[model samples]
Structures are given as structure tokens and as C-alpha cells.
Target: MELHIVIEGKKDLGGQLYRQLSDSIRSGRLADGQQLPPSRLLAEQLGLSRKTVSNVYTRLTQERLVLGQVGKGSFVSAPAEAKPRRQLAINLASAAIVAKWDSMHTPLRAPFPEERSRYEFVGGCVTPALFPIDEWRRCMLHGLRQDVKGSGMYRQAEGIAELRAAIAHHAAFARGVVCTANNVVVTNGAQQALDLLGRVLLEPGCVVAVEEPGYPAARMLFASQGARVVGIGIDQEGMLVEQIPQGTRLIYTTPAHQFPLGMQMSVARREALLARALAIGAIIIEDDYDSEFRYDGRPTDSLQSMDRHGVVAFVGSFSKVMLPELRLGYAVLPEAILNAALTVKHLNDWHTATASQHALAKFIADGYLSRHIRRCGATYATRRERLQTLFADVLSPWFELVPASAGFHLAALCKKPLDLDLLLRLARRADVGLHPLSNFYASTPPRAGLFLGYGGIETLDIEIALLRVRDILLQME
Candidate 1:
């Protein structure tokens, strides 16, 4: 049966509908799993339109107040009772969220690659399908059962000690970088690590050397911190260390699997970079973003392992290895910088989510993380091979594509300048998510080339996305 409650004016559109439905659920006017009236039916009761009712229901669903099953209907949720006591209804359509919008990577629209659907080539992604969700669920269940005791207390500022130890051990064994728990600081993501390091190290007008066409986030973080981010040109080998600006306090590079371009820095270049950093008294922020997924060659030794004068701060994350949503990353710091970073860490979000850190520790210690990386490297390589084969067999004869040497994507170097506005429009019309190379640069206006990411996509689906991509670009020709 349809539930009825009359709502008065325009003000009644939002909260009043929420109140009525919530009160119905809580007061037992609606029982658990009781299906809601269709939006059309609910609108008739309130003398309003369906959208207004749908909006309220949408907000309710977002708040965990009600659950919706598309083919069936919305149901009064038992969990809905938690939010009325825990969170307030917020109208975000009107309020501007004050995130210092980190223009660090490609300007990605929120909800970019919508919820693991087919035909989206969303870049810089890891598959949740491959995640240890069952293990995570078990850990959370166990945490709540025994360790949810600290209900209101803030988690440790240094992160979970066990997790920090696990991370330190993993680094020592996997990457050959030596670090103790004090040297490892868990962050929201690798971006947060960048932000935290930027905040502590960069001063107004300070110079930080960065690679041209580098990871956009590294460039953006240094720039946003009021640092003079000098873009040093890179070659097939790596960043030109000799070109590093004088008096620069830091140099940021993705030496292993350099973003978009996918070339690893050579040992000679690494030595020269370290030499230049030592000469200039500069620190190197090594963004080893996709170092784990090397398809072609041996993984380069990390700069941190080689630092004797403490010139490199290695920043890496499980977000790429795991899924991006987990918000797990770490920065290994030199002793001098460690205390300063910890202070900033305490001032910032205080700590990583305790349960996530704990869960990750358990995952790592039990060998799930390492196990996944091996599988991921093999899996992503297969998808990459298929995409590359499609490009080679089908598209590359006509289009100039840089065979993705490593990482999640392959880049198509356009013969002429691309009108990004029109390209994005075509991609949208075709329902594909790809990145533009220009979005990751320091200054020049956005230009040509598209990044075709294959991580979330299957090897089988690459042919279609590539075909559609070829069709879109061919229109310009």
C-alpha cells in the first residue's frame, strides 16, 4: 500500500519529505523492508511533482536512510535510523565545498568513471573486482566486534603502529628501501603525501625543480604551495638533471614509469640527479606511482635506498596497487624532515583511518598485497598487450601512438594540435573516459594527444574503445 503524508509549500520539498518518510520508518508507520510508493504516487500525496520526491529519496538513499532496488522499489532501511542521530542534512548544491582543488593531475570530473561499468577507459585506476573485499569485510567485522571500543577517540597521529611497521618491512623487502616506523607516515593518498611534503618544505617564492610533462599532481602541489616550480625538460632516458634550476630546494620526478611517457630513469641519470640535488642542497620527491606494474624491464632501484646525504623522500601508495578508494599511501622521510612532517601530519587530518590502516597491515602481513601485485602486473600487461595490438594492428598505421612502455595507458600523439573542447565532446558522445596530455603540464595552454587507460577495462573491450577513439579523432582529420 502507498503511504500518504501532505507537505505544504516549496520549503517543504526537501526536509519535510525527509521528516515524513523518516518518521514513518522510525515510528514503525513503515516496517523494515516495506517498499516505498513510487515517486509518482508519493508526489500525489504531497501535491508536488515527482522530481521533488525523487530528490528527497535520493538524499535519503545517500544518507543510508533508505535503500533502493531498481526493479523492486525503495525500502525503509533499519540503518537509516543512524544518520538522524549522526549527521545533518546538507544542501551541497548551494554550498561551495572549500577544498583547495588540487590541480595536480588531469582535471577529472567527479564521478568520472562511473562505478565499474563497461566501456569506460578511466585512467590511473585499479580494479575493485581484484580487491581483497572479503578479507576487508572480515577485518572490519572483527574490528567492530572487539576494537570499536575507542568510539570517539581520534586514531593515532602516526597511523597504526602495526601498519607502519608492516609498511616499513614491505619497503625493506619489496623495494629495498630501508626505513623504520618513524620514517614512514601514512597519508590519505600519494597526493596527500605530496601536499604534506609541499606544506612543510616549500616556502613562498622557493624554487622546486619539476619535470616537464610530469605527473600533474606533483607540479600542481608545488605550484599551489607558492613555490617557483621550474619545469626541466626530460628525454627518453629521464629528467635532464643538469638543467635543474639553481637554488631549487626540491626536485619531483616519477623516475619509475614516468607518467604518460612511460620511460624509466637510467642509473646514470639517477646518479646525476642525486649529484645535482647534493650540489644544490635540494631534496628529490620520488613519485613511484606505478612502479609495481612494470611490464617490459627490471624495476629501477628506488632513490631513497641510495640516499646517504638524505636527499630523496620516496612517496608511494597502495591506491594504485589496491583500489583508489581505500585512501592508503606512505612517505618515507629523512630523519631531519620526519619530525617536521609528523607535526604537519598531526595538524592535518591527524591520522589515516585506523580500520583501513589496520586492515592493510593485516593484508600485507598475510602476503595478499604482494600476491595481488604479481597478479596485477600480469593482468594489466595482458590488457596493455591487447590494446597495443589493436592500436598496432588497427589504429597506429594511421594514428601516431606511443606504445605504452609501462603503466595503465597508451598515448596517441596527434599529428596536429587538438581542440580539447571538441575532443572531450566527442568522447562524451561516444561514452568513453580518457585523459589529455596537456592537462598534466605546468603552464602552456592545453593541447593534443589522448591517454587511453586500460586498467579497469578488459583485454577484450580494448578493441571497441580504441575503434570508437579512432573514429572520434578521424573526424578532425
Candidate 2:
């Protein structure tokens, strides 16, 4: 008959109260149809104002998480499933828990509240101000009309015919990838595309190579599949290909613009990587995630374009160029593995949303996609330049900026030893959304640094954000 709760004065008391109560109900600690203490009485028990307690109840009622009776107390609603029984003792041999699942470690992404910061520089995001909402809506409507007129059936596993063709054309012209509609497989997003490829390619105890200070999700995906993932180091040119350990079955690289570090793979390295893959009979995943917004010199030829031995499986996503929420991306496959990949794709998701694919096809074919890219490219270029200038003038003392040719983000290696954990704490206290470079590494000792993405942060606010960062760096000194 004892209730337990802690009131932390430093945090949002009301929100904490709401979340705790809701969790108690959902977890079955608060029984279904059980009456809660009166608002006045409970407020006194919790050392909160009566109004605060009442507001929590009102909000819960609006969410339909609880029900109130007239002249009675608030009660917990019945859950869709039976409530879990409280555990009495640990069962070491319990069959329910998978040992592998327990061993895996994945960090939750930190949420950045715009209201908390004068300027927030979170990465892997696009500027919302440039999204062509009106045009997108029109294209969406056209897709809807076309779908209604056609037979509604489960679509082919590869993708809708129109979309595949459009993607192939875009890849050939824009990325210099020699592919046809038959080689393309549409996916929910680049993440799902990676998943599908992993499913088809990786096996238990298989060896997979990924860049250290690389994309975590891809590494986790391979690890989850029971593949022994090796973290290969990266330099100014990109991942060290010769360093790939022998017997590696699959290689995943973000060559166009390496994730987190934001450096492009050099031409010689690309050629070397492709040749090595061929020599070892290993398949490579080339994720060209965000090369559509090049602000520098001539664009480097894609690894896929140089691929002759069918060693490269090229992945591209609309998340960067168009919008992340669109959940659209495609993979250009090698002929040998295309059928197997298609089967896995079918099993994984059946197919991506059909209407959206059709609409995106029309958008690309009608030249809207290209035009939007040109418009946004100009905006992103300005943001990139501003960030570069700030680092050169102010942040150069503590940080040596990475020379990135393309993508939404730029990273800097620390010139001096920095306490990254402490820096994160100080940055958070100052309302800045700064991330540590070490977070991207798995096995290798991570280099101390920061990745400042100018994508979501507006051009006007870039200077303000950098000044705050500079102030924080000064405090460390």
C-alpha cells in the first residue's frame, strides 16, 4: 500500500509527474479501473500544488490513457494485453531473453529542442525553409489519382516500374552510374536498403568491414546479423582499403561523402578498393548518401561508375536531397545478386509505399527534383562557406576543420586534447547541440573532435552558434 516517487526540483516537475504516473498505469502497477487519490489529497502527498496534480489528470484524460468518473477519482484504463506480473526473482536460464540481444550496445540519439538554443547545429538534416511544399502536394495528388485509376494490388518486390526507370536515369546522368531500370530496387529508405542488403549478404560468423568513426546504424545492422564487424580506419582520402582484414565477406563505405568525418574517398583509393573487392571476392556497399549538394570543385566519379567487376552495390537516398520524411531510396545492384536481393526485399517489407514512389517518379521526370536541388544547393553552399569561415577565424585554435567536398555536415579533429564528455555537458548547459566525434567509433580508439552540421541550422544563425561554441572552447582553456 506504499507509493514511491521522487520529485527532482531541477527538472520539469509536472512533466515528470505525468510520465511516471502514465508509466505506472501502463506497466500495471496502477491496476485497471483502480481509483486514484483525490487531487487535493495526492497533491499534498507529493508536495505539489492541487492545480499541478489536476492539470496532470486533465492531460492524461485528453490522451485517453485514463478515465475519470463524475464525483469519483481518476482510474487506469484496461491495457490491450494482460499486464506483466512483477518479477519475484532473477531467472538466469530464462528462455525468453536472447543472449546476443543483451550483448549489443546502441546509444539513443539526443533530441535537440530549438527553443532551448539561440542556435542549434545538429547534423544529418536538411533546411526546412527550402522544401517546396506546394509543388510536392501537387505531385502527391497526381500520384493519388493515378493509383485510383489502376488496379490496386500488391506491387512487385523490386518497385513500381516508373520509379525504377526514373531512379536509373537519375543515377546514370547525375552520379555517372551505369545502370538500368532492371538493376534498381526501391526501398523504404537508405536504412531499409542497407537492411535488405545485409539480410542477403551477411551470415552468422561472417566477416564485415566498416569504417571506424562510421555510421553506427550500419555497423549495428551488420553486428545484429551475427557478422563480425571490423572497424577500418579512415584518413583524409577516406577508408583505408588495404587495411581491410583478409576473409572479410562484405564491405560498407560512404565514399561520396563519408558519414560523420565528411571526407570524400580519393579516386585512387576508390579504384584500389574496387580492385581489392574483386581480388577477395567481397561485395561492397557504396552509400552515396548526400552528394547532391556539392559546393566545391569537380564532382568525383562514383565508385559504382568505375566498377567493372560487379563488386559495388550503390545506395542512394532522397532523405538528404529532398526530405528525410519521404522515406525513399534505391540500390543499384550487381546482376549476380539482384535476384537474391529482390527475394530478401520482398520478405523484409513486401514493397515501399506505392503512391509515393509514383509521385517521386513524376517529380524527377518533370524536372522538379533537379530544380529544387539547384535552389537548395545555393542555400546550403552559403551555409557551408559561413561555417568554414567561422572555423578559420575563431575555432582554429582548438579545432582543425575537415575539408569536406559535399554533404550536409562537416567535422573537425581536435588540435589539442579535449575532455569530450565534459564538453558535451558544458555545451548542453549553454543550449548548444554539439556532438562528439568519438561516438561514431566502435573498436578503434576514437579521435577527439566535433561534427557541426549546417543543414537544419539557418544561415543567419551559423555565426551566433559558432560564437557560443567558441565561448565554450575558451572556458575549457
> How far is each candidate from the true structure, as Cα RMSD in Å?
9.5, 10.5
Off by over 4 Å in 1: 1-106, 112-118, 149-155, 403-405, 415-424, 444-447, 473-476
Evaluated at residue 210, the lDDT of candidate 2 is 97
Best candidate according to lDDT? 2
Using all chains and alpha carbons, the TM-scores for the candidates as numbered come to 0.75, 0.80
Please provide, for model 2 over 247-280, each residue's C-alpha lDDT reduced to its tens digit, 9 standing for 90 to 100: 8989999998898898889999999899899988
Clashes of each: 2, 0
User: Each candidate: what lDDT?
Assistant: 0.78, 0.86
lDDT of 1 by residue, 230-296 (tens): 8888787899988888899988998877776667788889988999999998889988777777777
lDDT of 1 at 424: 69
